[model samples]
Target: MPKTKKLPLNSLEWHQHPKLTTLLSGDCHQLSTLPDLQFISFAQLQSILDSCPIPVVKRAKVDAYYLLAPMPILKQLLGHPDSHKLTASLNIYSEPEPTLSTLALIKPALFYQKYKRLPEILHSRLDKAKSMNLVTPNKNQISQLAQISPSAFRKITHSQGGSHG
Candidate 1:
């Protein structure tokens, strides 16, 4: 076995995909050597970062740390039809409920605009909203209040480009 030398924190390099930029930590280098960019999508990496404990983050930052991702990615993620659901299936995980919740709070109306089926979007996440201790209209309630039929609602939603994903 051979011994390997560990670089000090500030000497460490962060690599980011050329496609995405981090919202808060926008300094990730575009170097080609780091392995993360090869194996992880920006979305997956972000979800992991969001789920990491605080101490681990501090230690990583001690190096010339950089995290890459863009707000639009965040927006698109927060914009998923199932964004509010945090459960994992087959080793894949949805965005954390809190992460989606925070993005929603930052721009409460963005989700509505992005998905184009504001009512249905709200409807799907009704339970999630309640679980997170947030207020939201019940399923089908928004449709009733709007006096739109499911068919008409579908048309309207589709007209607006319904689902982004």
Candidate 2:
């Protein structure tokens, strides 16, 4: 599992939405936890997550944890339509929502046609870290070593002509 912290099981995006009105009008929550959640007992879990307009809603007993799958639907909702941006968002999150192949279709529209946007996102990340003085390069030795570390990803993708930027 990726490293992640537990929040209140509330939405990370609580202010705006998938529209609570529509969600509430329906009797059930359109989503549940990931399939892995099936391993946990959702017998006591509500079929849906409740919604309210109040800024502060009391923390209800959470029987199951729901994650917004970082899929095409969410990408479109976030106004980032490029697959590279979508993929990047998925990769960089502290807890990237799980992706499902069947239902996770990206819409026809895209924010960008090419992933030229990838470098920009990466640059911004580095810039933020630099601004915070979080980067200290080892100029002489360790920094001189190959940029890509040996591991499952490197070994698999290296022969295919992929290089770490």
- Over 1-165, each residue of candidate 2 has an lDDT whose tens digit, in order, gives 333333322223332113323333444434432221222122212211111111222122332222322222332223322222221111112322232211133421243333333443344444555689875332222112212222211122234333324
- Pairs that collide, model 2: none
The C-alpha stretches of model 1 lying farther than 4 A from their native spots are 1-115, 150-165
For residue 81, model 2's alpha carbon misses the true position, in angstroms, by 34
User: Which tens-of-lDDT digit does each residue in 91-129 have in candidate 1?
Assistant: 111323334334335544555566556545544455457
- What 10-residue stretch in candidate 1 is worst by lDDT? 86-95
Candidate 2 runs further than 4 Å off: 1-62, 65-68, 71-116, 124-165
Against the true structure, candidate 2 reaches a TM-score of 0.19
The CA lDDT at 58 in model 1 is 14
Per-candidate local distance difference test: 0.37, 0.28
TM-score for each candidate, following the candidate numbering = 0.20, 0.19
Superposition TM-score, candidate 1 onto the true structure: 0.20
